[model samples]
Target: MRTKQIANRFREVILDGLWIANTNYKDQLSNITWEQATTRVESLNTIALLTFHINYYIEGVLNVLKGGALEIRDKYSFDAPKITSEEDWKILLNSLLDNAEEFASLIDTMPDEQLDNYFVDEKYGTYQRNIEAMIEHSYYHLGQITLIKKMLSNE
Candidate 1:
């Protein structure tokens, strides 16, 4: 029930089927070239960097969901790899989408009761909180990606 809802929310933001926002990461990033994604718009973070940042948390939480340790760090979230070529950009985009699907699938299988349990530690709050934060956080960056794309197109 709750897990399904959380998973749906995550899918809505990262994959397809728009609900809260009219777009998703796959929809936004699929057509962007490596040059466009890596282009700087003023002092804002590039679309590639933003994409990596969003996936960083998803992959981290996914590790814990899969019974691994929480190994993600804030300082390293934006440390995106250099997307020097079309292949590099494609790899990062594919990884983001793939990890997002896996993360959502894992959430979909979680028992409702597990959502109330601590994620990796009490400091991080419950699974529900963390998952919700992921959705919200993804949306926040998704908006940025959309704007950055628009800015690039206008240039």
Candidate 2:
């Protein structure tokens, strides 16, 4: 019973970080193409890159949970597709949402106390830090997404 409560709390954190409030950047940036999505008016990274980066962490965490190491190589580089076609862009957007749900599910079902038991990655920090970092990381990128949209809409 206690485990379930902790699991529920972790699930809430994941949901709140990834979607609950969500900063509404995705909603405002709706109907954007993958091309424009990655286009930065200045030195700033584009929405596609931000979105990709966000998912990149989610993917990386899921991988770590599945026994992969905390890879800090160039693998997390912003390398998402520049969708010229509207259908492709839509697919990516939906995929992100679905993946976030999947991530939350993973956290929700996990043994509650295992949240800090460390997966033991030698190269990177413990699983504890990684999971906690995702919340701040996602929020940081949300700011970027919001600013990028504001910039694009202004010009």
Candidate 3:
């Protein structure tokens, strides 16, 4: 009984993260290109990069939580899509949405104990911390996506 309750709560957080990913930002982040998105006022991070960053870590945490191996990539930490056509941007946004759902499926099956397990030297945090932190991480980029959209609209 208690396990189901805890699982439901964690499921809610994961669903919230997915909701943050799939919204439209006044046409700013949803369906735009890096070339179309770049601006002197905007850092190269752009909406596309932000989408990729959020999804990358999301996939990382989800895969790791489900006992899959992790991969390394050079994203928002060092550099990002400085030049991309509109088509590329749409592809990325779609991928993020698709993976967001995949992560949701992963969460749907999480055992309560798995949520508390410690995987040494594996992910950004212990399993519980990873799940908790994903909420903040996804929302942080969602906020960036929202702000960039606003900046683009204003320009």
The RMSD of every model to the true structure, in order and in angstroms, is 0.6, 3.7, 4.4
Candidate number achieving the greatest TM-score relative to the actual structure: 1
TM-scores for all candidates? 0.98, 0.74, 0.70
- How displaced is residue 64 in candidate 1, in Å? 0.3
What CA RMSD would candidate 3 show? Answer: 4.4
Q: Tell me which of candidates 2 and 3 scores higher on lDDT.
A: 2
* Positional deviation of residue 121's Cα in model 2 after best superposition, in angstroms: 1.4
TM-score winner between 2 and 3, please give it: 2
Residue by residue across 49-100, what tens digits does model 1's lDDT show?
9999999999999999999999999999999889999999999999999999
Model 3 lDDT tens row, 24-68: 332345445566455535344666666667767777766775677
lDDT of 2 at 67: 67
Residue 5, model 2: Cα distance from true site in angstroms: 8.1
TM-score of 1: 0.98
